[model samples]
Structures are given as C-alpha cells and as structure tokens.
Target: MDYSLLSQAPLFKGLTADNIVTILSTVPHRVKKFQSGSMISQSGEPVNSLIVVISGVVKGEMVDYTGRVIKIEDIPAPGALAAAFMFGDRNRFPVNVIAVSDGELLLIEKPDFLKLLMRNDIILVNFMDMISNRSQFLSEKIKFLNFKTIKGKLAHYILQKAGKDKLSLKLDKTQNDLADFFGVARPSVARALREMEEEGYIEAKGKYIKLIDKKGLADLTIE
Candidate 1:
C-alpha cells in the first residue's frame, strides 16, 4: 500500500508517511481499483468504510424523480469520500459516486478507522473539520439549486466565481460541465449563454465573457 497517498488526504494531513503507516498497521485496510465510469458507491447504500481516492477523479451525482441526473461535485485524488456520514445514526451515501477515470482507492472499515481516530487526536479533529467544510459546501449548493432558471443559475455561478465585474477566460469549465453542474440540459445552457450575450447582459468571446451589466445579472439571479 502507498502510505504517501494517505498522508496527502486532509484527514491524514500533517502526518508523516511513517506515522501513517504506523496507524494503518493497527487496522485491516484494502486497496480497490475502479475502471472509468464504474460505480464506486451508490446512493442510499450503507456507509461502512472511509474510502480515500489515492488517484484519479470521482464525481458525485443525484437523480431526481424526473430521472434528471444532477452532478454534485468532483472529488480529486487524495480526497476522502463520505467522511461526514461515518458516525451518523443513518449513515449512508447521499449521492452516487462514479469514477471519472480509472482510479485507486484505499479503504478502512468504520470500526477500524474509529480505532485509529481514538488513538490519534489529530485525525479526529481533522475529520470533524472536514465535515464542517462539507456542511458549508452543501449550503452553497442548496442556494445555487434554488434558482429555477438556467440563466439565473449561470449568472449566480459566474458572479460567485468571478467576484468582479469582468469574468476572465479561466472559467475552468466547458459548456457541458456547466450544464451538468446546473442540472440542466446542455442545449439549455447553450441557449442561455447565447441569449445572455445577445441581450447585452454579457460580452462573450471564445474563452472569456465580460459581465457588461452587473445589475442585469444580479437581478436575474434573484429569480
């Protein structure tokens, strides 16, 4: 097993590789690999272990009643999955986790992981801090999802990510990514962008868009 991967995780941050190896020695752990598009964890499934991505990407998604799949967020390498639900009374995966690329994961059963937590206070505190951060992320996501229109969602996302009147080319996302995140169809996002640009709300170039009217965007976000 690669102890270095564990050392990179936030839950194990600040610990030496030797220290991580020592901690793992007390527990029975395993490494699992997933092919691209493989189901790593299913929604509503029992959460029995703390799974950490050793490498590659993972995506969290939820399907609504209408069968529309909403992409939650992407988890990159050295990240822990379902850490916040470990000690919950009804611990379960809230979203389906799928491998975006072939990846390796290290997992420790709850009982064994809890034992390590008991032995190491740093890990325990780090785990709590991670859960707190997850709560804040969920709150922001809820606020973003509350917007009914794709245009509103797009505006809110751009404003939050930009934080200035002008948005740069470094959006770090494609149209399809934006559509998946907004839980809307790809064409819907495409149309919204086209309309926003045509309406003089934003000036769109190949990779950058300048927010021509901050008030116009903000007013649209309220809906």
Candidate 2:
C-alpha cells in the first residue's frame, strides 16, 4: 500500500507517511481495488466502514422518481467516501457512488475507525472538520435546487462566484461540469449562457464573464 497516498487523505491530512504507517500498524484496515463503472456503494446502504479513495475518481449520483440521474459531486483520490455518515444513527449513503476510473480504496471498519480516531487527535479533528464542511456544501446545493430555471441557476452561480463587489470573473467549472451540477443537459447550460449574453445580462468569452446587468441577474435569483 502507498502510505504517502494514505497520508494525503483528508482524514489523515496532518499526518505524515511515516505517521500513517506507524498508526495503521495497530489498526486493522485493507486496500481494495475497483474497476471503472463499478458500484462502490448504493443509496440507503449502511456506511459501515471509513472508505477513502486512494487512486481514482468516483462520482456520487442519484436517480429521482422520474429516473433522471443527477450527479451530486465527484471525489478524486484522497477523498473520503461518506465520511459524515459513518457515525450517525441513520448512517447511510445519500447517493450511489460509482467509480469513474479503476482505483484503489482504503477501508477501515467502523469500530476500527473509531479506534484509529481515538488514538490520534489530528485525525479526529480532521474528521470533524470534514463533516462540518460537507454540511455547508449541502446547504448551498439545496439553495441551487430551489431555482426554477437553468438561467436562474446560472445567474445565482455567477453572483455567488463574483461576490458583493466583483463584476468580472472566470467560471471555475466547465459547461459539462456545470450541467452535472445543475442536474440539466450540457447544451442547456451552453444555451443559457448564450441567451444571457444575447440578452445583455452578461458578456461571456469562453470562461471569462463580465456582469453587464447585475440587478437583472439578482432579480432572476429572487423567488
């Protein structure tokens, strides 16, 4: 196993490679390999272990009643899988995790994870920080979901990225990424951007955007 990769994981952020090896020497854990497109975990399944991606990309997705698949987020190497759900009474995966590429995972069973956490203060602090950050992310996601149109979602996203003073900024995510995040088709996002530019609401040249009508964008965000 690559102790360096394990040390880079968010759960072990502050620990060194030597530290990880020393610690894991006392903990029972295993490294598992997965193929691309394989299911890592399904929604509603118990999160009985602390699983961290060691070497690949994975995506979290959900299928609604209409059978439309919505991508939640992508987790690459060193990212923990369902870290927040591990200890809760209703500990279950909120979305199905599917491997985007062949990868390796480090699995530490729940009880063993608890033991590991208890043995290291840095690891415990990292775990708590991860959970708190995830809560804020989910809150923002819910707010975006409340938007009724793709244009509205795009407007809100721009406003949030630009902040209170900035009027020009570059989009951090690509059109395809934005589509997955908005739970809409990629062309829908591209069309919305084109329409917004055509309507004089913004000036877009590739990823760079200059807000032309800030108030108009804000109005779109209003319920």
Candidate 3:
C-alpha cells in the first residue's frame, strides 16, 4: 500500500506519510477490490463501516419512481463514501454507490473507525468538517429539486455559481454532466440554455456564459 496516497485522503489531511502509517498500524482495517460497473452499496443500505476509496472513481445516484437515474455526485480516489452517515441513528446510504472503474476500498468497521477518530484530534476535526459540508451540500441539492422547470433549476444553478461578485463565469460541468446532475435529458439542458440566451437573460457560448440580466435570471428561480 502506498502510504503517500493514503496521506492525501481528506481524513488524513495535514498528516505526514509517516503519520498515516503509524496510525493505521494500530487500527484494524481491511482492503477490498472492486471491478468497474460494480454496485458498491445500494440505496438505504446500512453504513456500518467507514469505506474510503483508495483508487478509481465511483458515483452516487438514485432512481426515481419513473426510473430516471439522478446522479448525486462522483467520488474519486481518496474520497470517503457516505462519511456523513457513518454515524447517527439513520446512518444509511442515501444513494446507490457504483464503481466507475476498478478500485480498492479501505474499510474500517464503525467501532474501530470511532476509535481511530478518538485517538487523533486532527482526524476527528477533519471528520466533523467533512460531515458538516456534506450536510450543507445536501440542503442545497434539496433546494434545487424544488424547482419545477428545467429553466428554473438552471437559473438557480447559474446564480449560485456566479455568486454576488461576478458577472461572467465558466460552467464547471459539461452539458451531459449537467443533465445527470439536473435529472433531465441532455437536450432539455441545451434547450433551456438556448432559451435563456434568447430571452436576454444570458450570453452563452459553449461553457462560457455571461449573465446579462441578473434580476431576470433570479426571477426565473422564483417559480
């Protein structure tokens, strides 16, 4: 195992390679290998252990009543899966975790994970920060789901991304990725962007978009 890579994990942030080896030397854990396209954990599955990706990429997604797959997000190497739900009474995976590529996962059982946390102040602090940030992200995701139209969702997304200080910004995700994130067809996202531009709300060319009427964009998010 590469201690250097493990040291780069968020939970091990600020720790030296030696520090990670020293800590893990005393912690009981196991490494599991997974293939590409494998189901890691299904939605509502118990998160009884702390599972960290040692390599490759995985995605969290859910299927709606109509069987539409809504992608929550992708978790790459050194990312901990469901770190937020590793504790709490309702500790369960909220989405299906699927491996995007062959990878190895580091598994630390709950009690051992708790012991590891208690043994190191830095690990404990990092764990808490990770959980808090995920909670805030989920809150924003829920807010996005409330919008009834694809245009409305795009409006809220652009405003939030540009923030209060910037007039021009580049999109971080591609249209295909955005469609997955928005839970809509890729053509719908393209149509919505084209419509928004035609309406004088924004000037978009590829990934670059300039907000022409911030108020107009904001209004679209309201209903």
User: Over all chains combined, what TM-score does candidate 3 have?
Assistant: 0.80
Residue 152 CA error for candidate 3 (Å)? 1.5
Q: Give candidate 3 regions above 4 Å deviation.
A: 33-45, 56-76, 95-103
Residue 220's lDDT in candidate 2: 80
- Cα lDDT for residue 103, model 1? 88
lDDT for every model? 0.86, 0.92, 0.92
Clashing pairs in 2: none
By TM-score, the candidates rank as 2, 3, 1
**To one decimal, what is the Cα RMSD in angstroms of model 2 from the true structure?**
3.0
- Comparing 1 and 3 on TM-score, the stronger one: 3
* Candidates sorted on lDDT, descending: 2, 3, 1
Please write out the lDDT profile of model 3 over residues 41-136, one tens digit for every residue.
999999999999998899999999999998878899899999988888889998999999999999999999899999899999999989999889
Q: For residues 108-198, could you state the per-residue lDDT of candidate 2 as single tens digits?
A: 9999999888888999899999998988877888888899999999999999999999999999999998987787899999999999999
Instruction: Give the poorly placed runs of model 2, Cα more than 4 Å off.
Output: 32-43, 55-76, 95-104
Per-prediction TM-score, please? 0.70, 0.82, 0.80
- Badly placed stretches (over 4 Å) of model 1 are 27-45, 53-79, 95-105, 162-172
